[model samples]
Target: MFEQEDALLTIDELCSILMIGRNTAYRLLNSDAIKAFRIGRCWKIPKAAVRDFLEASHTVL
Candidate 1:
């Protein structure tokens, strides 16, 4: 659902959007629990990757 021209998101943005704490988000990103890439010292997480993660980790409710 992310329609920004640039699909990449910073760690802070990811945390804000996902409603998770910084540590949890970093842990997930660092552990490859979600897809992410680095440019210099910053992370660039794709919106699609987050969507995929949620979809894959969702449980029936």
Candidate 2:
């Protein structure tokens, strides 16, 4: 779903892509709803994970 090869998105980029606030992004990361990894104090998220989250969220519940 990403154009770059193995692109890692920053929290700010993620927030922009999802049109969500920092609090919601942190909640998703903390809640494990969106898979991500930490490098030191920064969180790095995969584009695939965000795509997956969007796909999952669109499912009828």
| Candidate 2 residue lDDT tens string, 1-61 | 3787767899998999899999999999999999999999999998989999999999945
- The pairs that clash in candidate 1 are none
Q: 1-61 in candidate 1: lDDT tens per residue?
A: 3877878888888988889999999899999989999999898999999988888789533
Q: What are the lDDT scores of the predictions, listed in order?
A: 0.88, 0.92
Error of 2 at 16 (Å): 0.2
Maximum-TM-score candidate: 2
TM-score against truth, every candidate: 0.85, 0.89
Poorest lDDT segment (10 consecutive residues) of candidate 2: 1-10
